[model samples]
Target: MRFPKILLIPVLTLLITACQTGYHLTNQGYSRVQVDSLAASADSGMARFLQPYNQQLGQTMNEVLVESAVPLNKARPESALNNLLADAMLQYGQQKLGQPVDCSHLNYGGIRTNLPQGPIRIGNIYEVMPFDNQLTLLTLKGSMLREFFEYFIGNQAEENALIVGGVRVTIKNNLLTSIEFTNGKTFDPNQNYTVLVSDYIANRGGGTAFLKDAVRRQDFPVTIRDVFIDYFRQLGKSGKPINPTTDGRITIQ
Candidate 1:
């Protein structure tokens, strides 16, 4: 069947323009909004329609990563991805500092989103931590360190704030013990320990009341985002197998 070429051109153009226009509506002459009631209704609507999909998407991504990558012995799939990221930060810090940094900490809330499944991407990391928090090194006395551990245990359930990098610790009967590092090293109280943790951790935001009393603290010139990006790039360059599993970095005894 022969088609009318002239009529088809005009019809196609109108269809394209209509699709481009979309369905956006502008309210003419906006006045004061008594939106407290409307806000509540909108929140409830979102909870009903959007919350389930978001949770499902997170779970799906987690599963995809598991299926796509060779599982590592050190990964902790049950815990949040923030802990895994904190471990990477600590590893990078140890390489640069020329000494074993006691721990690396990142706030649970700071990890805004879950890691996507399948191939890991830099954009996913950005979505997880949208903030510009930088890495900070802090030195605290032995007593202050003990207090820091105490603070961690106190709010362990309430806030997922502190993730110990380069170290493994257990809380037993509300007491901290059985400390170890990724390289099977233990902490020395007398030695001046360098901690590679977030600036927020040094500021005591993660239930650490004693962080304010740190003896020596300095913020590194680089942002945490830069650290993660570099880590990912280096992994690609070295062809080192990337595993998203968690070792016994943070544990409950």
Candidate 2:
């Protein structure tokens, strides 16, 4: 999340220009301006104007939220980073709803970067989950839930397209052979279960159109980034470092 000094010049120029323009300007054809060594020496006013804002942004982004015991990287089927995010969503959902959540999930593509093994900063979380996707709660019959996974299994390519928590899935030959809840409860097609997912998926983004048919759905004002921040802060408060590990939540044979 480190902002390069060179990139900041163009951004600062835009900001200064915007501030100077008293009226809205219509967009027109744009051309790239080279920001080489010559351009670097040309703008003392812009540099002065950008200094404070840049410093403030840097301070905020660099604030340490928590520490990670191990480098959390994303991987197909299952990985420590995926497990950590899914588990965070599940725990946060349960706390927010004041009830047990059956499961939680996030699209693998949503994770943009990996966290290093040491201090996790606010910027790191922002880099990891850049989308402003909000958390959404959905209630679906077990049958509908099965359809959700079926779509995932059928559509997934070389990469693991999904990360899930509180549910174990066994896939073989591109088929979902079995699914079990970690709570030791049976998945009954007739029974309804609560699921936590991003608003993007609930709205049928990422090829999950079946989610639009959920028996019940609720959108929260919370964003996924904020949820991770809260979770990390809570861990910091408890004197715990992030040390997530894969638990075979999703297996392929």
TM-score of each: 0.62, 0.79
**By summed lDDT, which 10 consecutive residues of candidate 1 come out lowest?**
64-73
Local accuracy of candidate 1 as per-residue lDDT tens digits, 1-253 = 7659978889898889988946766766757756686465666776789988988777644421222144222122125365567767887787865545777766655767665445556666566667788888888765566567666566646644345666667766666776565665556665556677778777676567667778888788777876876665666565444555555556665
Clashes within 3 Å, all models in order: 8, 0
lDDT of each: 0.64, 0.85
Candidate 2 wrong stretches, greater than 4 Å: 1-42, 158-160
By lDDT, the best candidate is 2
Model 1, stretches more than 4 Å misplaced?
1-80, 97-100, 182-185, 188-191, 238-241
Give the TM-score comparing model 2 with the true structure, all chains together. 0.79
- Candidate 2, pairs of clashing residues: none
Error of 1 at 82 (Å): 4.0
Could you say which candidate leads in TM-score? 2
* Model 2 per-residue lDDT at 97: 57
lDDT for model 2, please.
0.85
Clashing pairs in 1: 61-117, 74-246, 74-247, 75-245, 75-246, 76-245, 76-246, 104-165
